[model samples]
Target: MSHAPTHVTCSDVSFEWPDGTPVLDGFHWAVGPGRTGLIGLNGCGKSTLLKLVAGELRPTTGQISVAGSIGYLPQDVTLATGARVDEVLGIRATRAALHAIEAGEATEANFAALGDDWDVEERALATLDQLGLAGIDLDRTVGELSGGEGVLLRLAALLLARPDVLLLDEPTNNLDLRARRRLYAAVASWTGVMVLVSHDRELLDRVDQIADLRDGEVRWYGGNFADYEDMLAGEQEAAERMVRVAEGDVQRQKRELAEAQVKLARRKRYGQKMYENKREPKIVMGARKRAAQESAGKHRIMHAEKLTEARERLDQAVEAVRDDAEIRIDLPATQVPPGRRVLTATDLRLAHGAAVAGVWEVRGPERIALVGGNGSGKTTLLRTIAGLVPPTSGEALTHVPTRYLPQRLDVLDDESTVAENVARFAPHATNNVIRARLAHFLFRGARADRAAGTLSGGERFRAALAALLLAEPAPQLLMLDEPTNNLDLASVRQLTDALESYEGALLVASHDVPFLESIGITRWLLLDGELRSTTAEEVRESRWED
Candidate 1:
């Protein structure tokens, strides 16, 4: 019998960027042979930690020890412009293997040099089949592959490496629903120690443990995403208690300092009278002066040093115990009237250049999730609805106002300013109003004047949202295409909060289960040959935490 390896360990770890902002501090964790979901908002150092564990980055302090070989697949895809798909996979450990094979040096040393064993190429082919790349020519250039297809191909190649530990960063971001389901199932059944960072709540629920990174600290929770949610409530309550206790101590110290000052002043006044009176005895006056001096000296020392230290401590305690700190940005009001059936589509079908067709039927005021496997036409349906693409057959009716926020914020003019983008959407709105609305979304003053192209993904999303709300009649029918992509955790939360309150029909096509859940999606349309209504059970049962 063999035991599972204790894969990765980090002790007394801390990290900081060049600007001196701390990302992680005093973080310690031990990952064994199991699935671990690393959960955190964007830029909380989730990806940074993954890179550190993969040995791609060095920690500013402390030690990281890995038990064996590790494979990491980043959320973003990196493709060599002119390289072939099969060529990319072969290059991974093949140069030496091929050299040995070509040199007629067929030995155990050569075979082991390629990987742990000789069948590396065979394993790669099988992995390629698993990713739906079996029949395709492996020698095709990567530049010829579609964006979505390339992502899958690279992922398959990475999986073939058969590493002891796998670090996946938002692995499901660009995948369709079917592909996502398959990926989720694969992750849940994998034997190695798998650490994944994802915003999808469904994925989080399948993991054995969840490590929530927040405020430069890791809060370990046993069980799945649902368990972590319950634990989070308790943690928030405890943090509040700490804040209350610190505040009470602060008040008590203020009172003590006031009382001490009064006593010191009285002693000084009495001593002066005794020293000035000619009839007073020399011994009494001398004693009075000495007592006064000692009292004043002691009071000064206590008030300046000890009392000051107490106050400083109180401040630190209060700072450490923040309870309700979250993203709370004010967005511009759309105030669009809820009219009858802003959008309606029935018996709708879509295809990818006459290849794969998707089924769909959606009604207004109904929150519908278009779900299917990879190449299932989720985007095709969205494009058809947005009028970017014409449906092959079926009727799509728009009764009232409508607006769309695409998955790619390409509608934005990169060369334009943030204010200019808003103005373009609502040409009638005055400059002052546009600026005010932009400020509400946390784009204030000089920041609003910055070029739109230079803004971070989160900022760009916020700006586009601002532009959308500024549209005339403020579309009651809002369509979002993967709106949460590239947004930070705080920004995602803010976006969710905004959508939750919007009193309009929402039609969103997204793989982000948590974001969907947050906004309360009721109906689901599975993109098969035709639209099929999905119950909550179907979704809950099939959706696994990554």
Candidate 2:
């Protein structure tokens, strides 16, 4: 497909928090007319950078020039009280232009204002329709929409604007499996330049490019997340070699400089001290002085220059791969013997309102992935397992203890501190013990005391997961519902590593195919009206990139 040339060009940008801590340092990034996945570890300024690109936040230094109009769906948006999906779309300027005709406000001036061809109404509806949001009434209030619906409404508004660039920040955070698929499909169909910040491995895989941000810089990887991982591994190995070489050079230079210093010292000492008593020629003394000065100056210059060069080379090498500095905590979790049939269901069915029901039966340590297009009922099955909903007319039983991580990090208490939340969830543990445990999860000292509500999405998820692990005896059956929704690459890796080492059964319902595979998922139960066993080969095919 021939594509238009759309891009977001930023040059010499720098940003610092109000408190003066540097967040971004002379950052330069470029995104072109294709889906570019923004990958970074948690707290790495990915969201902040995305905001700057979206023009929501101005750069503290330098200029950001976007080639065309912009559409931004931020990671967080609180719908007005009692507002409905329809109302949110209506707030968009393009939608207003379309609505003007119905109210007889589409005057000659309005037509001329749209430029030569006019027909602004048609264009507006077409844009909305492309996102599968057309024909929705504008009067509906935003407060009545479901979380997933609210997300789609915001997306619809952005797309209807026919933006030259689209910036979506953590777009899949609150979406269920079905909604996520829909969102992905919508993104896939979008033709303009797109930059999205998300922890969703599935979404990252689908994009054309992956920009892995660490500290304040970007490393462009031309492929899906898996490909990026492979490249990153190679880069890391190369960087290590460079660091070793630089270290050796520095050592060699130090030895040479030391030798030079010794030689100069010996030469000076060998010279007779003919200050007043010895009959030494003045010309000879002057020659000696000149020789010593030249030799010392050469040694000093070489040593200083070599030292400066070595440090720069070493720093460059270190910085090249430092983006992956996130600790990969690969320690094994405490084991719990799995009971027979972790969860069982027969002819189970569930649905919300007019949406069709989803049915399935889950048993064993299936490592199941509820695969389906967006709007499918992957989350419903998880909720059913959690006993949040009763099946329409079927039998279901869970024989082992099941812990659920909701898609929205809902396990965390907004008002309570991280330590408090962990302690509350773990009643048997004392305060000191709980604090120590929280520290293991990277919530230490002042961080542990901070309110859970104020923590970033990744932090909140980690805190919740830490709390879950602290459960007495560790859950025999763990259920993670879209667990990668808001996680950055580091958090994702850490969580995956922990889960891989977990001894208990895992039933993760996620779109993160690479993550599931990395942790050794052997089987899957594709959610639909019927259950299907998926092998590794099948799972590979189910990857978002495929």
Q: Can you write out model 2's per-residue Cα lDDT over 1-546, one digit (the tens) per residue? A: 224567898899988888887778788887888889987777889888888887778888988998878888888867785765445654334445545655789776555444443454465456556544465555666665566667777887777567888899989876644556668788888788889888777777788889878657787899887798898789889988998988888788878778888887877666645534346788878787788788888887888788778878878877665543333233244454443467777666665321222444344555665554344567777787789887676756777777888887888889999888888777888999888777667877999999988787778888888888777656767888878776777887778766765666677776666667777775666654445555655655654322
Worst 10 residues of 1 by lDDT: 353-362
| RMSD (Å) per prediction | 5.8, 6.7
TM-score quality measure for candidate 2:
0.69
TM-score of each: 0.74, 0.69
The residue pairs in collision within model 2 are 82-143, 83-141, 83-142, 83-143, 84-141, 84-142, 84-143, 178-374, 178-375
Query: What is the lDDT of every predicted structure here?
Result: 0.73, 0.72
Once fitted onto the true fold, the runs of candidate 1 whose alpha carbons sit more than 4 angstroms away are 1-6, 9-32, 52-65, 78-152, 213-222, 262-290, 300-310, 322-339, 344-365, 384-401, 411-460, 470-473, 487-490, 529-534, 539-546
**Native-to-model Cα distance after best TM-score fit, residue 493 in candidate 1, in Å:** 2.9
On residues 59-144, what C-alpha lDDT tens digit does candidate 1 reach at each position?
Answer: 99999998877878887888997987667775544656757876998877667666544565567667766765665565678887
